[model samples]
Target: MIFKNISKSKLTLAFISIVITFFVWQQGLRDSLNRPSVTFDISQKEQEIAELSLQSIPVNLKKIFIINDPVDQINKSLSDVSFEELTERNKLIRIITSELNDPKIYKNISKDFENKNFKFLIDEIEKKSNNNSYKPSPDTFDLFKGDRFLYHLLSRKFDFDDSALITKSFSSKMFLKILAIRLIPLFTILIGSILALKILWTTIALKKFGWKEIKYLDLELIDMVLLIAGGFVVLGEVVSPLFSISLVELFSRNISNELSQSLKIFFGYLFMAIPPLGIVYYQIKSLNGEFNFKKDYLQFNFLPIKYAIIQGIKGWLTIVPFVLLISLIMNSLIDNQNGSNPLLEIVLNNNNYLSFFLLFLTTTLLAPLFEEIIFRGILLPTLSRNFGVISGIIISAFIFALAHLSLGEMPPLFVLGIGLGITRIASGSLFSSVIMHSLWNGLTFLNLFLLRT
Candidate 1:
């Protein structure tokens, strides 16, 4: 360990770095609490899926996927006192409830709306409620052409003659997307619950489920702290972004805004990874002057590639239920919980294929690789050596979650980090944890892609 020979200056530097990281990260977390969440967008897409399935898919399949009247549920979701809020969710709730001639909903439509088409729809709904028989113009359908799903919802209300044709026009492509959206989470959670229960049983009865500690690095706790707090946070996140953003801005002046944003994220991540990883490389080199790259540092252990993949898959499957359960609890407890990563909204709203592809590479590939290396490959093993395996796992996971600077998402992310930590130690392979992190992110990206409809 470097503890015996550690200089006072190095320890002081580590202390200062950790304090700076804490304060800055705390401020970031506080700021994140006020940031808008993507939950509303996700809810809207799920509701659209339910509404579309009702109109397009077979009754049996629809029944299997959608359990209740989606519009009725939307109506129930509306706050009695917050009807005057001009949010997108409020507008949707009013539109859905207007079919039932809700007097309260009509009263709230006095607020001005920027969308002329939506304003016209509200006007038509009002006229219909008053028994005016004021028919919507033929161009009314064309007005909502940009949002085909919303067009379908209003078609039934207006009794459009082409409603049947439109319902029948549901493409096989859309059906598959909807199917994946509905089935993937359901199946993942189901399998995860079973696997989690089995793992619990083994832990309690057989005592065969636990992390096995291994010292992967000959570094002290201060070294680990400095690597993460100083190298990763200060250099990688703060300093690297300054350069990466400038580089991207200088060269991307002629590109589309979406493409520019995507490029910034991709290259920014690559740049950010460089300093911390470089520090790790130098630290390894310093420790073992004539070291073998593969064996002497960060036991990737990919000789048994299939084993790593399977262990990763198992870790992912086992972790889903716990993480999702935390998410569900948080959502129920906090209305409109914020601090959703801005990248989620970007991915959801992005229409350009190139932009989307770049984003996919950033999230599903680069993020997993870099994060696993820092948190699992380096931090976890060192902490385990200092504090024992279980404390090491919890503390590392807490730091991992805190590093995201998203307070609303912290609980679930902490749960996810725990799963990654356990997987790293139990599998005895950093490659397994990387694969697990990649799978977790890849599934989230896939869901977002499917929800774009």
Candidate 2:
């Protein structure tokens, strides 16, 4: 009906919609540039209560031979040695003290002494206790105390600067988790508003919009296809360029870097490449006639796959502007003890523009593919099944935010989570969610590159 009402005069309105979308995206990127990528969960599970040390003792006295000889026998042979003599080697002192306190020293590590390997230490301790002359030699006791000091010293940890991991609620870091719950729904509303506006604008243009988005956000088959295809293109064009197969140092900061990199690679193969080529490996056994839930969810008919992708892009173009607007607002508000901005640091963090580009590609492309598989594909279906669709969307969105571990997630992240979930449900396809998720992240990457610079 709107199209029937349109004339050449309306064509100008269509161009205006696209320009508005780009402006909003650029603004959001500028704001998000300074935001930090999350590294840990913000749930108020266990307060640090006290700082823990990470530096191990400076000494390497992991082993020393102290035989079970009598106190009189030991005292006579080592008469010239005083209590101070035992501590000559710091490592030796550590070993002696750790052994003296049976629980503190060998207790944790003893389990790892593979191949029936731990009997020697167990036997020595047991044998000493069995003998009547087990007076606990004075020099050995001194050695034990010194080692305890070293154990505590070497385990020094980074000062838990609550500043490094703060969420920007009106209150301090202590109450961030509580505020997050309340904020989740509000963020959903804001994101939904932005998406709706973008959708209307896209409709006015010739870009094509989706079917009436399920008011509650359920993706039809077509929605899924479009999301996957657009997201995949962005990933292939932007993300694949970040590959650094030979560089190890780039990943040094990542704890599960190797395993994560491998999984990312696997997903990249599945979604970004020609489908069923890899996905079919699962289906070859049952590909003949029956298409069950397993097949419906996992298997693909190329026609539907291609159709769905076209739909997803049309849907995304309409809604993308709103996503960009919220993201910009989310990124702009700053949080840091050192007053560091993630946006500024993007370039400063990587002296090599190539590395920065790699970071950009990975964030925009790779993360969305894997994340969608987990969140929209795996998590949303699982959660929606557990708690009706609405509950699933809320909880899945929360988990999405929590999944991204880092200090900087306090802002638009929760909103992004909700957006990702809604997009998946609305399209009734994981691809829709992937497009939205990648768009959100890609905007941030652009923030780092375009705005922060």
Candidate 3:
């Protein structure tokens, strides 16, 4: 039990890490949650003035005023405007309404002028005209009847400028601060939970199994090929069409988008789970009908329930950092390539409540169970028996990652596969890997859920 003694020392270190992680997380969370709220009291007049000063006049107004080529002049005047100068309403009006009297430009001004300011300015011109030659168009005021800006101005309601607020909230430094506040605490807690479980399992495994009773499977090359092929056929071709229109039609006569999506995912999970479970049963039967449900069949015999939880935690913690790093690298590469991960796109875009629930259930529960049975339960031990432990784990992990058929996702999936492989070997139970897989998927689902919300 030299290995067990080493495990005990590792367990103590993991426990200390967990304690420190939690302390830091708690403090960060407290600070973030207790930050003061922001409030704004922008008045209607201020908003209206800001909008008029900032926004360019309508194209129709430019055509009418014969200012079709004044882009430079207008930009220069806007840039040079001071608060003191802007306070003079008459001067501000003159600056905005320049070049309205040229004959070439006036010829372009038709009765169809649609600018909001046109009617008001025309009325003023008519009042000042001694010859009474110009008249305001009857239809000019019709365009502003239900306008949002006019309604806001008339109502005199106080509101914050949304663009300004958004810009302020997402300034680079502020954004990074917020991200650190939220992410660090969350990751710390997750890792702490995993380490705590590992410590508990080390103590329990030492007492119960004494490291000798752990079972291993002997898998042939043919078994590996068949398992891999069967998995691809089921998950890729068979389960993929669960979202097809024809499949949705089979579920109900009147299928809404949500219902259709839910049924698709539901059937998808069923297809994924049944075939793998059958494979697992066949594998168990091939073992001379010797079934130790906990150790041999289910792979849950490394320790009692109390210590077994540690294996699950260790598996997840092992994969998380690798997954995160791979994800970051993949995202950067994808950005450079100007491409997207289709599976991620689908998960992100599909936000229906029932659809989300179905997706969550499939990924977190069904996927973990079936995938673990195939990869960890059947493949890992089999490969280990044929090859050395390290080679077997690496090979199995590679296959597991490749099964997803996503270049962007492969690295992280491989990392996850390695973690699960290690868990299966260390704990001597497939169930432990399954728990770890489930927790990892559950966390991924939760992260997506929070982001969408």
Candidate 4:
């Protein structure tokens, strides 16, 4: 009767945990819907990259890429928009790209910007465009440093001696941007397609392509509820941040906003990890009656490191196409979808080296390690032991996606989680899933880095 009562109590607690987690996840997703999507930012970067490429790309390369005449393209983009609708930056780009023989164009753009320095720069550019001699000032030198291509073009018009030097520098930067923008997608699709076919063939042959049940440390359903709900959601996400943020606020008062924000994220993640990890440790100790790292822990087999790495690579490649397909479908179905993670915008816009490094560490290294340990290493195997392996993989992936609290991103993230779960089971190593997750995030980081001007 006591045993039955204990089981009933555990079941009731598990039910409560599910209800709380669901409510929290729903609120988070709803909140995310109000945030601006990252796709807009990505589009802006693409436009910037394209504009810069047109300025310095070789004529032969432009022909190969089928890039249209940049002046015509810029005119088309600005055609329907009135002067008031155009941003200050867009106005500057338009004025720089235009033939300044039109006096109205010069007056309209220069008069709208109230800043004397901005007006002065516009006036000089107009003079240079019209073959009227204008003395170069320190602001012009700053412009030369800030935007070498714009400076080089203006210098060529004014017949400045340093135009050739600026041209060389501008060309090198444009080459890298163009190469990265064009090659990254092609490389991903090609590798992904090859791996996708291999995965299909392996599935048909019934050979090493599915999630397999593994013998893991004994854990009850209530233990999972305690770890995920009490430890992760309640303590890690909620309670722990209270302390972490307080500490960061105390120490980072004198720092720049960017640096302070970075510290908060870094320390916040560390603190959040502690409670769940502590729970894991405690549960392991309780279950085994003693802690033996090698014998009584999640599987992180690294003996065949090469095989694990290869499997991880293969899993990442195979999943890329599926995830991309889901993202495309979502985009097609939803217009201006919100709920992109705000971290993406921070990474894209951050100029400070120290802050960027901290973010890089959090995303590429720490996130993969901690997330894989929790989801695939522990949660997956425990769930798999209770349910069927396939059910376990799906359920765990769903939970993983929910934990991210992004509605727009959940489908792709869920797909990616499934891939990680499959990799974890098929390779029989938590190390493989960790590698795959790291590679996924590292690729995103690299893309964002390349997009930086």
Q: Using lDDT as the measure, which candidate wins?
A: 1
Clashes of each: 0, 42, 2, 0
Answer with 1 or 4, whichever has the higher lDDT: 1
TM-score of each: 0.87, 0.36, 0.54, 0.82
**lDDT per residue (tens digit) for residues 293-362 in model 4:** 7672788887688998998888888788888899999999998788998888788878778999999899
Quick one: ranking by lDDT, best first? 1, 4, 3, 2
Predictions in order: lDDT:
0.81, 0.41, 0.53, 0.78
lDDT (10s digit) by residue, model 1, range 130-181: 7746567656668676666767666667767655435545644566777888
The residue pairs in collision within model 4 are: none
Misplaced by over 4 Å in model 1 are 75-131, 140-143, 161-175, 204-215, 290-296
Model 2 over residues 167-190: C-alpha lDDT tens digits?
232122223322333344356546
| Runs with alpha carbons beyond 4 Å of true place in candidate 3 | 1-181, 184-186, 189-214, 231-247, 289-295, 331-343
Task: Compare candidates 1 and 2 on lDDT and give the better one.
Answer: 1
Error of 2 at 8 (Å): 69
TM-score winner between 1 and 2, please give it: 1
Compute the lDDT for candidate 1: 0.81
Residues 297-320, model 3: lDDT tens digits: 656564587566777877677667
TM-score of 4: 0.82
lDDT of 2: 0.41
